[model samples]
Target: MLALPAESVSEADVIAGILALMRERTGYDFSSYRAQTIRRRIRNRMISVGIHTLTDYLVHLKSVETEALELLDRLTVKVSHFYRNAHTFDMLREEVLPGLYRRFGGPLRIWSVGCARGEEPYTLALLLEAAGIPGTVLATDIDEAALRAARRGIYLRDALRELPESLIGTGLEPVPGDERHVRVRPALRRRVHFQVHDVTGTALPLGTTDFHMISYRNVLIYLQREVQERTLLQMRAVLRDGGCLCLGEAEWPPPSVACSLSPLPQRSRLFEAIAAEPIA
Candidate 1:
């Protein structure tokens, strides 16, 4: 990949070439991402890899599987923290959990789709535990590096900045010798599972409408609108009727998705699945 005259290629041609190489060699597709973001990321990756053009980067990907995976990881990295949206988690803790507990009983199952670094799922587990509701969380992400970090179940002290002091030690315990880090309690870890999965891929991790809630915050905004619609439909199919779907604060479902879901009275980002399509 180094020998080719990468400097002469147009930026458009370079991004196209990179996209093509990803599709052909790895079967990973970035086509649904916003074009501007794609271009910026390609350029950034080029700089990181010491390459001046996407064409040379394509050649580099072909030669190094590890580097290819690293690029994929970089493109998908998410900087999420425990209880990202305080108000949303507060609502879940006070109103949503109690209602769901009355409706479905304890030991409910949750799926945190597009989970990056495990904060969302861990927060759910912590919330449920604090609320005296027993639930299991299944967190999935497309980035392997993110999943690996989630599996470690450890986080820096500042990750607690958003937390209220009263809730401390309920879900997190300080590591034996480290003052600057805390580990999600081993018991909570048992309740939250992490796996690597691409939501847009051919297969879904969930085979039925079994989940009670799917906390897929902040991820849909990265995908194109049509992809967001299709992903919502897929989510509807797998989410049990009456289940809750949590999204990032700035995101809203298209009307097509809103048709099958009802927004909670107070929360804009939280929706209840209604009259979902029956699963096969």
Candidate 2:
């Protein structure tokens, strides 16, 4: 019988080791993430540290506290902005929200999973307020630092520069005395609640809400197929019948599951839940 070649560890192993440390220390798991992208990020960290061997790098990570956290931040990929996709916002404003309003008259509930830095949930609050819809938003993320930043509800001026002039005019008011930070209006801010939550773990802190909409965009791409399926199932359980689930333009549900697809204008990926049949 031929003996198997010794398993050669590379930069990827170093990357995985660091991520595993984060999971153990912080309880935020990225173990199920796509390997290639994780490898690339780890390689970048290796170059930054000037370490060649995975074994050496693991030892280095154990010694350095701040550097390890910085690496984890880099790997988590928390890039987000207010109304990041204009077309999707437009669809929500014009089509989906109106339908939801007609169906569920007042006090609507929305969830923004993986809500990095609160932009998306705050944007939803602004939109709902502008449209004269009474709603509360539950915004959750795995990163505590990100959640804290979001809870502050302050953003740099440049972050809002690209916001639609109409939305800026109606929804947001500039922060007095601080040119750099913009505060979400009192009413809109009151409607949004931010919490730190691990998506791969148990359900969020809130109770079972009558969720008419969920914005879970750009999050599923990082998760493995099994995690994605479980997350989607949990999302479906929370969502009301005929409610909508919005994904980032680049993201899509796995082909195996069945859900109603309602393509919004300008290529917005607004999907409505298919109503279940009543028991006889």
Candidate with maximal lDDT: 1
TM-scores for candidates 1 onward, in order = 0.89, 0.87
Question: lDDT tens digits, residues 128-233, model 1?
Answer: 8888898899999888778898999899988878877777689899899998999999878989888778877757875334888888788887788888888888
Which residue ranges in model 2 land beyond 4 Å of their true spot?
A: 1-15, 50-53, 260-266, 276-280
> Tens-digit lDDT track for model 2 on 1-280?
1122257765556566778887776667778777766766666777788876566667787888776676677677788888888878877887788789899887889999989988899889888988988888999887778888887878887777657878875656788888887777788789998877778776655665669998999888887888887777788778887888888777777643334434454566777877643323
Q: Candidate 1 at 177: error in angstroms?
A: 1.7
TM-score of 1: 0.89
Location of the lowest summed lDDT over 10 successive residues in candidate 1: 1-10
Whole-model Cα lDDT per candidate?
A: 0.81, 0.77
Candidate 1 C-alpha RMSD relative to the actual structure: 3.9
